[model samples]
Target chain A: MDDLRGGCTLELGSMTSALKAQKILGTAAIPATVVKTSASGGGRGCRYGLRFSCSQMANVRMILANENIRVREAEWKDGS
Target chain B: MEGRELTYLDNAATTFPKPRRVIERMNDLMQNSGGNPGRSSHVLAIKASETVFECREELSDFFGAAGPEQVCFSLNATSSLNFCIKGLLHRGDHVLISDMEHNAVLRPVYRLWRDGVIDYSVFPTFVLEDDGRKTKIIHGILSKLRRNTRMIICSGASNLCSMTMPLAEIGELCRREGILFVVDGAQCAGHIPISLEEMKIDALCIPSHKGLLGPQGCGAAILGKGVMPKTLIEGGNGINSLEADTSGELPERYEAGTLPTPAIAGLCEGVRTVRALGIERIAEHERELFRRALIGLSQIEGVKVYCPHHEGSVLLFNKDGIDSEELCLALSERGICTRGGYHCSALGHKTLGTTNGGALRVSFGVYNSSYDVDKLCEALREI
Candidate 1:
């Protein structure tokens, strides 16, 4: 796996929405992965989030915006 | 009898000899595109997701839904009705349904009533009527409306009698009264034209296998503007994976788990075939067969035909001395397939006053022919 500290995560409302967003991003050629919500992030339990390389964070956001998929929140972890 | 050609007249239960294209499309999906939709970024998965979305769009357009998002897939019309009825009604809410509804609608509402979650009433359906039947039925429904009545659920056509309900008028009544209207289109979706926008229907539950010519295990609920039922099932929708509850979005809010992608592919072709052949033409052909069967059965001695004037492709009747089951079995020995007894619509039998003896139902489809009708009439005459 890539360094966890060098990636960005997007919290979504449900798994279906996340999967739909993932498909749209994949069709647009943006690499993304759906994963469990971070436990310590005050995130809603049993939710999912999409993680991508920190370097492509802006591009991913722009693509999701174009598709009109709402993002509940975004978080970036910094490398030590 | 062993080598005789089979005559299938149980279309109301589920259509047979599905459109050629529907069969081919389902086979193609099973063989070439078996990826789990919306589960990953692989090429097969992406292609599967696209196919599912395209199917949704096709269904939405065919039903005149607000958009593809307004369409949600389910196992069958019963599941769709459960989602709509349970999601929309609350404790103490009053619901109105017609007496002709199948068990799909009746059972769910009854379960809710039994649990004291809600209460419902069955309104009357009109028989062979003169000029004022529509007006009388509408007035009867309006008279029963109470301050607590929140929704009206009805079938587009009677599966037992084959009588087409005045849905557009009923929908108008619901609109003016500000009551939510839902329709069970199990017997009419592919045989009739339904425009959700024009009909002002809040929700429509349909089975793909019966009228849409698709395989079993596929159905859809089309939501109209400003209508949102509570999610029936909560699970992975492949979106908002961080939430503990289901999504509040259009389809994602209702649809859960892995969809039946192969059935949906078949549904797409089914709708396309219906559109290409024209629903009116298919309906007309079935009506012709229904008319011939009705005339022939009515002339037979000791045969009592019900709903003789119903314009749909179904006919219900019984012989004076023969039990409906025995009659059906005799017909079966002659290679004819018909459904006897209550047909899972006990309420419909009650309405038709056939509760005591039940009736044999012979339903037609686009594939049925004059020869099939003639064969059925000949068998009835002999028995």
Candidate 2:
């Protein structure tokens, strides 16, 4: 639901890593929606990423760091 | 599970009577999340990706891989073995394999040698009783080591008989020599306790349908921390779609094309079932069944059981004056499912001196019991 409400998305480079991040976040009671991340030019080649609420960015960062999941990039999208 | 009441003893080829949960999970996956894994961000695709990754995670934990990404899916152990063998070895590299290797390992290495990409040697395995046996095997391998030896590949357990390679010892040797250690875990993954890191195994090739008790058409190459082989077969694995080359990742680099989500789902449940039953308990059960079949067959007149000293999940033997194929056919007529001829193991049959007629292999699984052994013995007596 948080993903539907305007939040931050963290690109994790691959589906395996995105799923891994999702699982780790779930254990921490954070909801995440796995999304296909568009490349820098927004073309066909896509990586996997996680979409979550912007307010949980701090907690997500801390959890991901502790879990050693390096976020390739992060961008915020308005949930309009 | 949905077939006739035949007594299946060819567990070495592929384990039958998969656990109920494995079937259930596979069915559930097909019914619910049937989509290509890692292909899209849609709900079904995401779920499919999750299912595949979950299985990867399960297999990684089961085999003691560095992480889930290290587990790469393939058609079976042969494909994984090919991927590892063809990808890892370079020109002028010398590979050492044991005498009990199945065709999966033997063929690729043979082809590589014939293609002039590498040189290879076959080291013999000797069982000298308890503590001294490992040393003897190691000594045999040490004598065959070449200056360019790049890898040592062996069966975790022989598919022909109960003979098991001293993998930890060989792995230790490879680690010390800075040579890669790879194991064809066709007969040992679920039957034996293996820690890839602990054993310093660079790669372990396994089949989902063998000791794993999952459905066929799926397997994995569980790579160690630093063992990254070149891509044998490549296309797209939902990553780096723009690049002409494959991904520079752990499994995605290897697992090209479509992922077998349902089979992987079955495998996840299968591994869970194995853990539930306890690997030690299951292995002991098979060994006990093996002991029973061994004793029963030995007592029968004109029956010759090979490797009577080795206790394991598989036993090989032949009846006197009977062609192996004929005996196997007779057993089949009696509703006993077993393998005859060379079992696709030219090296193993030669090593065991059964090349002339090969032998009958009766492999035990968790679902099998002493009753099956008794039935096989009684049938042998009748035949």
Candidate 3:
């Protein structure tokens, strides 16, 4: 929670976006679990593979593009 | 659109922005002279037949053939090649072809080879430093001929890199060997001046859509002297429908179907358009475009161009660290249309050392300009 505080937005390109996300999550590998939340407009259910709560992925894309980041998009694996 | 950038460099495959006169003539013929040619003595039928003859005449004069009647209309270059190779060949006959030949010449030869219809060998063009050295290179093909050699098929100019084959010497060799000499003029028919008599070519298969600026589904083969082939396809010749048999003449003997009258009319207009521009001027314009692309691509860092100092039909190259397909996608996104792949000449890729996949090919045409080449180079640099 301390590492995720301050909303310290760094214009990390797609390359650094994944690294930073992994560091903030404190996981060398993404957890293979589904988490449910009640904040979603739709019925939120368990999701996997770094599941976005709402529009975090879209926000990251906008931030990257706005800052002219030259990063390739991260590959997302399917959750069983 | 003037300020906007858009370039199309894939002319060897097919041409766009077709000649206005060709389109007009096609419309005029369809509206005014719509009838089955030679099927009736009615005015419309006679007019349609006349239109067909006029197109044959146009092709005849374009290629310096003996007469207009010698030109046989077909679907395209592939069908024309089939008519020549399959009709004139048999089991155990030997065929001498070129390495730069497109699939039209290759598939039929291969089919024949697999079926034991013929024995074949392909002579690669010798990369010479000087243009004058082409004569000696031609003699090399002649030296490999066996006694039972039935024909020699070579392209007028390579579809890959615009390189003109030494057809005249090959024609002379075939003439001396008592073998048929066929020239696949798919890339050079209307863009370059050709003479059947002067070159002693036995048959020439050409595409009306490429250099001639005609409709896509039309082509012709200018049959040279002593080129009577056995029937590969049998159908109505329109002239002798009641006979229930194919004719044993030149054009009528080979063209067996309801002829493409409208397309032929359009093709005639295409030939007329090319004739008015002058083939020499057309060739020169395309050559200048090639020269610009070669120079520009060579100047770009990490780009390896593939013209090899020869003024050929296609400009092939690849930028370092980029896949050919990826480069093509990038170019297409930039409105710079090009062909990237093996170009249907898989054998050529192995020889050119691009068999891993292939290289990006930018072929030129009379409609293309130096600015197109510049835009392509600029976009490649950006990538």
Candidate 4:
């Protein structure tokens, strides 16, 4: 994971959304993990996303976009 | 009553002897992963959340929902109906319900009407009539469609009798009229086939304990895509913590409190059992039992079976010169389980013209057989 804002992390809306993304990624054989973002780390108080490797960033973005997930490019900021 | 076998014919109330997998899954959840689902990020909490979400996905697939997000768990079918009828209806909106609707549908709609928030019409289900029933029902609904009619609520199958609502036809009518179609699947979820999408239903409310063969205390309101209703109740869904409003997600938006994870886990397994056994097989089994009961009861002197030609899972009748409740008590004394009286649907009683005294109901489950049917008839004859 590289150091950037939402770069390696896919900012899905909720835990359900993140789990859905994980399932989607799983079927494609892409690697992802459900991570809870802290208030200061991601965009809001409590957010969930799929944290993946920096190298898979482009593929993650492209695949999720195809599935209408609408994830943004950001860094995997560790929660406080 | 000691040491005697219980016939257990009141499945319309709640099923007894749930599937083995259902009980095992619930026990497994409580003992192993009894954490708050979607609340914390701990190991047990994550397991609970995953189990709950898996149930959501399983139900969504079973009911033909768009995705797992559409199926929201609740306490039971009554709460789910309240959620849909209350959440979906706006001020001044008109709704139509079938005459055979249970109190689950009638009570909430009555409250909204009493408060002057909305008005409703009761269309005839013709639940007792056999000839041209579907066409008559469709015509009845078309006649009752007001200009502001927003939704049409009907049961996929009646709780009182085996007469089934023509859900596909009613769904098509609602679609053509641009009204939401909601089906109360409390009596038919596992007994008969239902597809939310193919039937054009906006929402389908089902109870886990009844036909689905899950334990009591859980049900769901499965929504179709783009049918988001207003929240009937609001609370933390582990999303949008700081915000005053709840999360704007499919299930979390409606699911306001901590979900009944154990019951949901059980419901998931229950639906799996249904899928493995095949709903078609279950439907015919009940129908065959109903046919035997119909013949057996009809052969008895002074016995009457309502809607005898209309066959599914439930059958309603009463004996001549015998009080309905007294008959039920006598049957109970003989180790037979059955229901009597209005069965909580005044509308249904009026429709069936059973206002003097309500009929006795003997409902069947997949576990029932000709022996059970014969036993019921034999007990009734002795009574």
Off by over 4 Å in 3: A1-80, B1-5, B128-133
True contacts kept of each: 0.25, 0.57, 0.00, 0.32
Worst 10 residues of 2 chain B by lDDT: B124-133
- Which residues of candidate 1, in runs, are more than 4 Å off? A1-80, B1-4, B128-130
Q: Which DockQ value does candidate 1 get?
A: 0.19
> After superposing candidate 2, which stretches have Cα over 4 Å from the reference?
A39-44, A78-80, B1-4, B127-131
lDDT of 4 by residue, B11-92 (tens): 8988877888998999988887799887776778878888988988989888899888788889999899999999899999
Tens digits of lDDT, candidate 2, B1-383: 22448888889888888999999999988887788998887778988988888898999998888889889999999999999999999999999999889999999999999999999999888632445778889999999999999999999998888888888889999999999999999999899999998899999999999888899999999999878898888787787688787864677878789978899899899999999999999988988998888889888999988887889888888899998899889988888888889999999888888889898888888888788899999999998
The TM-score values for the models, in the order shown, are 0.85, 0.95, 0.79, 0.95
Instruction: For candidate 3, write residues B110-145 as lDDT tens digits.
Output: 999999878999876754344664776576686778
* Candidate 3 Cα deviation (angstroms), residue B255: 1.9
lDDT of model number 4:
0.85
RMSD of 4: 2.6
Pick by DockQ: 1 or 2, better one: 2
Q: How accurately is candidate 2 docked according to DockQ?
A: 0.57
Candidate 4 at residue B26, lDDT?
A: 92
